[model samples]
Target: MPMDERTRAEVERAEAALVEHYPRLVRLAYLVLPPSMGRHRKVLTAHGLVQRALPWRAPRRPAGALPAQRGADPGAGYDLVRQRTVELALAYEERQRPAVLLPTVPFVWGLRLFPRAGGADELALDQALSAVPAAVRAALGLWQLEGLDADAARAVLVRAGVADPEAAQRAAGQVDRRTAGTAALLNSGEFDPCTVQARPTDLLRRRQRVRATAVLAAVLVAGTVAVAALPGGPPATGPVPTAAQQALDPARLLRTPHEQWAETSRVDFTAWPPRGRQAGDRQLLARALRVWAAPPPGTRIVAAADTSTRPPAAPPRLLYAGLIDNVMVVVLHDGERLVRYAEPEGATPTLHFARVDAADLTSAGGLVIGRGNGWLRYLIAPWVSDVAVRDLLAPEAPPHGLHLAPDGVTDRIPLPPADGVPCGHWPATQFRSSPRIDDRRSFLVTDLGDLAPVHLTYLPSPGAGGPGEATGTPALHSWARTACTLRSLRGTGVRAVNNWAYAQQDLPEGGGTATWVCNRADTWRGPGRAVVQFLPPATGPADPGKTAGRARGTAACSPFGRHVLGDVHWQAKSGKWYLLAAGSSEVAGIDVTGGVRAGAAAATLAVPAGPQAPVRVAGRLGDGRSLLALRP
Candidate 1:
């Protein structure tokens, strides 16, 4: 057909845009296209879409189209090509199979080409974006690739024929809330199609194909003869299976009603509300279930000790399904264990299973959804009304309010230091539901390298009833100097760690008062571990307290046992040495015999002594039972 002047002019403008901004235009299309389509096809299809965006004949612009974007070709050509590329990419996503509408030049037969593998952030964003709608994905591309805000991005979507631009923009906003620094990742060469790495496909298999052809033909003939010789041919088998099945359907997943959390007597994972932005997304849920049930070969599977990696027999209860830390995560509970299925963008997926056989209200309150860069985020229970983070090592500092999304996931908080490192601030997540400021039920939990965090509590005295939640400033300050000791309990399947401040006494020579606290780590498996530490009076932040004694496989600091006696040699600022011994409140008197002979009617006894003094400390309880000091 003969080209009119206007059509020729439009084509010439588009040609100029392509010539000047070919790489940027192709990258925009590449990001807009679905990542599920192999990178090879995405690279080829992205190039093809950009080329076809330039119409042979003049194209009609849609209504309400915005002017050309800033810092681009400014001739209206770049805008025309960009919108057309996004439209074609969206259309391609809706197609059944991969196809490039126009022939992509420079295509090779045997080699597969793909963009360079990106870092963890890029991979995570890719995986998360794959679960969103095509229009949402397109809006993200415009925002990142074209540097357009919500309004400008929506205008582009509307011009590209999106039915509901407002809804797309809102959905994109939700994604933006969870993901950070996406533009930088999207702009990196990780998504640049023009610059790609290429490798031959199945070289070994291709090389051996001809050599095995004759052998395969002979085997096929023998198998056909053998099948024919069987009695009544091959026995009847079950009907052929189809792609659709009830088990894999997302709608079939067992979901507890939102109200069940408050109405039910149970307070375990079964009562957790169905939370997360993508919870209702059937496609994402289906993919999650499929990957969990039959994870592809090479899929990474991690399981806690004694935890089974078997897939659930039935569709388990959905706890959460959404994008967290740039990755798509789906948490499920099968009444026995909690399973976490994580799919990082542009990378292999992973399955983590942790034993939660009998989770209690405290242990089931929250779970680590994502962790990275020395920070941890939690998917908290719906019943939780308030969230705050406190540094256990700096108990005097006020707790910082933590933000939570509508889905009940808390913002990332600083992680505690690892073992063998100098004592640093240990951050603990504080959760409470009651309205009262001094609610004794408000609990504190710290991550210990497990799916469920370890609960922290304090027992001020034996007469103070059972160990209560650590809420008051006194309890916080007591645990502050000893929280670093919990690092040794990491990955130990510990259910709770309690600090018992049993005795406080004045030091010798009027130095100052000191407190003796015992910490106990109760594991799910039976045995308990205890560490007795002597904390000097508030001096400075540099003091993290000293571990006086430790006992394993004992119930020393527990509610049932409730008796601990420890001694430590201290050096006062006057350069004088003294022996300090303390016992649980139940003790009537403590006697420091041997090297330093001294007796105190109270549970604490301090007497002057020498360094490395061989001291024998013993205590007599109210019931007249003798208690011996624990050895470190």
Candidate 2:
């Protein structure tokens, strides 16, 4: 059928308007929905909803009729469309249940139409908004983003099914409180409205066709399945294991080695370049044996070394070295059993042992010399104790190597010093080292008795750019002292503790002040411990405007592990002025100096106030490993 000129013009005008406002509508929809639904899904749903609400399909009036001939308010048409779209989206979501529901509006537009900005702050706002319920989010969007007043926002929320006006007002207040900073950022030109690009008409039509086909196909398949399942049959089986899962299965790998394992474990024999083909062959065989052993769950063999690479003067000993996950795993086959040792990358290694069986021995081919060797060598290595294995491996060093005594022997094996520092009173149980960063700093954490970790940070010294300097001895000693103090504090029944270096100031004669911060026991039912520091102003005329008795320092605490602290303010709750800090987990508070301290009792510290009016404060965690905090 041929369309009349008026009707055709109206259709074109509606499409042009939709195209112009498509991106804005999509952004609004995205903000309306929870972020858990993901950006892509939200954009698509929003586009669809908007398209469906277009007035092109409405019954046409007689020729020469006015815009209001059908009783439509031309000025308020957009609002009506938006409201209808939101309602449709909500209804679709309700009916879809487990499935992804289509939003009320519709338009064939690409997601690139909506570009995101605002960086980390924007991301934080999005995450915060996601935590809010959909209704609350809608109210916020309407009130803040849409610049609607309280009554207007309430009306929108009421239309969206929020029955209580008080609830709507409360939601608006919460949004205002939570997004105050974000709103400032948004208004500060951090985010510009995304420009809409014109998409090809053919591409848009093709997308619509594809979407329609997908919907029709889905409906047909659903109908067919419903008819076929009219009579119940046997229960469905669980999903089949994927190829990756099958390859990773320890049982399957033990029974029959997967072909993928060969590639994963292959090592270049040429890298060693043995003196003779015999040595090279031996090295190849050792590499093959190490590969055959395979890594435990969540680890992989990155590098391997063995006796084949040993010097001719060295005694005959079968050894294999591999990187398990990021940790180093070294295996040695003794006459009795196979000794397995593992160390986190750059950390002290730990030792274990496993029994060898005849079948296991044969699995390694000619590599087996001891009765308990062979494939059984790889299978039986059990982790012994949570201690460093480096000392056990290096017998010729200062500390004698750990000797494997007979069963029931009561000899204590000597272990090497961790990071050149004697363990002393603090024995290392487990150790972890993070990857070296910028070739300058690396962190090593040693799990001491009772899981108290002594964190060591290795950094380049003055005049050195790489990680070759060894000038951190003083820092290490300082950390050890702090760790000891924290250990004692823990002994006093303190829970949920962490320690960190808060402030450092260079002093005269190359000396410096290093302040440490730690969370005390949570006996007060508050969020966490509160530590406030005060430092006297620097002497001299460096800043002539500097006032006297002005104390400057940091205050910080954490209820759990390392968490980014949010806003801090003097909040008055129940007639008490509390120094409160908010984070993602919970808000922590400590009684301010001169605040009401009666009702409840817990250990309290007086924040130093030395005649400084309008006292300024800041909070800090710690730099690298200077401050240590324990995780439960």
Candidate 3:
């Protein structure tokens, strides 16, 4: 049935706010549920319920605050939505497959966990809600449902003769009595989802074991229902406990015999090859275990995927790669691990092997896609940077310049052609041809390629926008003669264009502009500050004009990787440069830094954490020290 104008308008308002907050809310719901619970199932089901119960329409333009819910608790709106949703769901449950039951209203709450709604606390929320009783549930559903104004609802109640405040209060006490009637079902105002449900389950053992198991079969049921009530807060995954406040000082680990060989491939210390799951309780693929820890140098080496070198075979599985930058992982999966590897032994490397890839090669690591695809096809030579190097060579120019762009980093600014600059022109060279050093880190070895003083000019930030939006390109142009190399550093932003590292930023009220980077020496400045090489540009829409971007007071700079990044969001608040680095593990940090010696300090932010997040993810739970989740 078409919703009435009033309901439609209310839904539209709620929906707008909902859509804005959905991503975080859904993620939070899932976190509370745990992957094993199939949070996906609950999410799909809940969203479906919302669609049917509260269809929305275009809202009439309203100047300000929504119709107030006088005398109604803040949760009243959602409770109404929940009640309506449940009615629809229960009717359909007869025909639907058995699935996890979820709360219809998702007003994510976790006071302490603002800006985030995931990780461990979600689990607690889940446990707490599962303990809600029938009466409490009814009260919760009726009161928190969406779109009902308190006065209107109260008027309806008055008409229904449910009684005035005094009478209603008397009736509420009976449900309250039942709510905490059982020891297992304590009506503690404070919630503890996990334990709450567990107590009920325990009670069922003496009464109805079979019934208990049948009722809460799906994990999502416990997860969603329990967590749906609380405000989503600090990411539970939080950061890894600070690593003893000390650097690995790699020098300590017994130096492997093949240091040169290891460096050749960029030995990644955290090379997790895609998670290998062996739920059968059997040994995980032996080859996987073997590769988990680097081989003891002297052990007999086998093939890349060969499983024979190692013994027991287990089910093969995909592994998550945990690799450090500038480290090549020399994986010899002891014959057994190879069970999962596909082998076409006779195959040969095509003259032009496939291209464009990423594998945790840097600190600000994520997927860095080089924007220009057509540029490569159009170039006369099938190469990245058109530079030439002989025997041992160093990375000079963009592609070879360990940058985040399609090419590593682009040394766009030529430090001005010097009197004795080699070739005196930045020549075109391919990354493959460069001589590498410390884990793909190599110097611009003299023999690598011919010196070409390539003067590639570019307009600065706010490239093509009109008026005040006209943030120009890097005005400070440099002439490159000798080996122009780039060493990838860290920075912030989302996709290549959305990234701040390679873009420009304008000051508020159209003050001045600052480009994303400033490269000095071979090393690139990082986390979106300092001088760094530019990645080669591929054709795309010209950057938004500084004026266009700055209108909202944010300058388009670097695009974020997985986390969202934008000038409007990050820039407006702090005129200073910020780096949205994969600060640590899954943890994304907002920080600022200067030149090489510059130390980075975390910026106050509100991001959630996960099981695999980094250290310093959240400022120490209560103390200055971070809190790590340990299974009790």
**Native-to-model Cα distance after best TM-score fit, residue 26 in candidate 3, in Å:** 15
Go through the candidates in order and give the clash count of each: 2, 23, 119
lDDT of 2 by residue, 1-632 (tens): 12333343344445555666665455555566544333334555666666665654545767897663322333244455556455545443322322333322343453323334344345445545645566666666666666778887677666866667567567656666744464464443223323333323334334545866997898787896766784577776754754333432323312112222223322111111111122223343343333323322222111111111111121112344443234444344432233444555543333333222221111121111111111111111111211121221111222222332221111232222322133343321122111221222322232211111222232212222222211134333333333333332221112123323332323222323322233222221133333322121223211111111111112234323333222122212233333322221111222232322221121112222223223322222233121211111
Please tell me which model should have the higher TM-score, number 1 or number 3: 1
- Compared with the true structure, all predictions reach lDDT values of 0.78, 0.34, 0.26
What is the TM-score (0 to 1) of candidate 1?
0.58
Candidate 3 lands at a TM-score of 0.21
Please identify model 1 stretches exceeding 4 Å from their true place.
1-252, 280-297, 304-310, 420-422, 434-441, 591-602
Report the lDDT of model 1 for residue 581.
90
Error of 2 at 187 (Å): 8.1
Please list the residue runs of candidate 3 whose C-alpha ends up more than 4 Å from where it truly belongs after superposition: 1-40, 47-145, 149-357, 363-632
lDDT of 1 by residue, 1-632 (tens): 12443344556677789879999888988877766565777888888878887877754545785543334345676777777787788776555323557355546777879888665356556655765777887887787678887787888898778999888777766676556677888888788898989887645444445546966887787897766675866676644422224446688778889877777667788988788888998988888888776676336565544466655666788999999988999998888888888889987787877777677777887998988878989988866788899888787788889999988889988889853356668899998863322242678999987778888988887789888888788788877778877776766567788888888878877778888888888876567889899888767653688888988889888877888899999999899998889888788898887877889898887788998889889999999899999888
Instruction: Flag regions of model 2 displaced more than 4 Å.
Output: 1-20, 59-75, 92-118, 184-632
Per-residue lDDT of 1-632 in model 3, one digit per residue for the tens? 23543444456545554455344223222222211112223344445454444454534546785753343343433434433444443332213322333343333321111122222222233333333322232232233322234455444344323335334333334333423332222222222222111111122122333544665585456787757756676655523422211111111112223233224354222232232122121222232333332232112222211012222222222222111122111112221132121111232110000111121122112111111211111111111223322211112223333232221223222222221233323323223222232232211211110011111122233333221110122221221211232211111111111122334334343434433332221111122221222222213222212211111112212222211122211233334433222121222224322221112233223222222332222222222443221110
What is the Cα-based lDDT of residue 453 in candidate 1?
Answer: 86
